[model samples]
Target: MKLLPVFIFSFLLNALAVKGQGADTLKRPIAVQLNVGTQGIGAAVNYGVYEKLALRLGVNAIPIKANDVFKISGFNSTSHVSADFYNIHLLADYTPFKQQPWFRLVGGFAYFLKANGNVRIIPSDDYKYGDLTLTEDQIGYVDLNVDWKGLAPYLGLGFLKTFPKRKFNINLDLGTYYLNKPEADIIGTGILTGNSSQTEQFQSNIKNYRWLPILQLNFNYKF
Candidate 1:
């Protein structure tokens, strides 16, 4: 029995060691970068920690809203507008297709800051139809779990190039997030003599299974 344990350990170690890095592989650049992208562009810092893997951390905003969803039927019109969200992500990317120019894939996880969320339903109507409105003041923080919901998945693809002369690399990444369409309650009022029923339960359209592409023009300092 004792010998079996030792043999198993040895076998596992040998399997890991069998993967070899050829001379050209060793020369590949290791890098660190600061990047910005859409959905409230932000700065992210990442460093190559493995043969073709990078660890990253970043923060982005979730400013979401509908162009127009309200038109007071007859005498008044109602519009439902959403506030925004702050999302922070931590992820790892494997540049398996790094050497290629046309393709690259990156996937990871994110932490959404929901406690600092603000949901306001603004009704833009005439003073006569003026009613109550809601802001961060009312439903300041959601009554549900914000931390667990923060955990999300991330995916990205892009074109990459390494400039030997400049000694740095540049790439453009297009990515999106997979979020569990958050279901939260929003209570607000428009400071008017009337109220709108449209903005009442209009939280369903925040976003559903959608890819909000973010184009990142990033610079990487290779070592």
Candidate 2:
């Protein structure tokens, strides 16, 4: 329900006696998720904290197309919106009906690092924060650039296996939030609309505003 300012995640740290598995019914699966391209190099590690639960930590950089963003805000606005993220998550996995379609829900908390950008909407040549000067071009073209860099929550769904032996657990998750309620930011309610209050302008930065869908492919080595 809240986004913490920082993320500290540990890998599959449980003691698995059977080569790559746990001694009993428990196991810690240390893994690495990679981005197929050079532009997106996101990586993460997950753990098996409980039979029906897992936790993870990851670091990723997600950037929106400058031209696409410019189309929405004209050429004068840039978003300092939180896009670059260093996050950690705690998830709850449940397999209610093991005979039906393979389904799992992962929910957890994470810290959103302040986004870093090169297109400036805010002029930075005149401002200074912690020993660095920012350019307006580097800030992009949005007026309300607010970053929730402390804490945030995420939830996603994925598949554990297909048919028969449940060979692997391939997953795809989308974090379920933009920012905490009542918080001030340049998205969601913070965005103003004419004619009506029903608008979808703040999806790119409030919480789970990934530039692209988060695709995770995992290989479970069990004993």
Candidate 3:
């Protein structure tokens, strides 16, 4: 993951050199972009290699956490939920119509450095056995974890041109990433130790949760 940016930068420099030697009429230019959306905030470098074709290399990260957002149907508990995702991607933008430069078909693949979700559930109220109240540690907690870390393919559409006519431009990307299958596990402590048996069922239920939707807005600056 640490070397990804170096590779992308090297590739961008090579593309620039090639563009510099091309014909003056060729619409090959380089741009830098910043974006934000469901995938989180990120930045990318855009290189126009042809009049209707461009390439982008970028990285994105989404880290979110919430408290008391989840609960068991018949249990009184407080849950902490968190999701963290980090990826590096390379994308191609192709304009199918010369007259419609503002519309583009986007295809890409991302390598996720980290993709994980966690839920920790703790009993909110004290439990009593006969006349004795059980301590929190005696009642214990349950932790559910899921990881989707691998290559994901992206397919989307872009609105607005890949490059600015002058210095800056704004665009939108509407897409979805099909993530790899996830690995899930359940851990329990103290009285909840038996919850670990549900790991298999949890994995089965989340097998199909691979689609990650993206609605991103990009701000571009031509160089």
lDDT by residue for model 2 (21-47), tens? 433655445444443221245555555
- Where model 3 places Cα greater than 4 Å from the true spot, the runs are 1-24
For lDDT, the strongest prediction is 3
- State every prediction's TM-score relative to the real structure: 0.57, 0.48, 0.87
Least lDDT summed over 10 consecutive residues: which range in candidate 3? 1-10
Candidate 3 matches the true fold with a TM-score of 0.87
lDDT of candidate model 3 versus the reference:
0.88
Which stretches in model 1 have alpha-carbon errors above 4 Å?
A: 1-30, 61-83, 98-102, 115-126, 129-149, 162-166, 190-212
**Model 2: residues with Cα > 4 Å off, grouped in runs:** 1-24, 35-41, 72-83, 115-144, 161-169, 181-223
- If ranked by TM-score, best first, what sequence of candidates would result? 3, 1, 2
Better of 1 and 2 by lDDT: 1
RMSD over all Cα atoms, model 3 = 5.8
Whole-model Cα lDDT of every candidate shown, in order: 0.50, 0.41, 0.88
- Give the Cα RMSD of candidate 2: 11.4
Deviation in Å, model 2, residue 32 alpha carbon: 3.1
Better of 1 and 3 by TM-score: 3
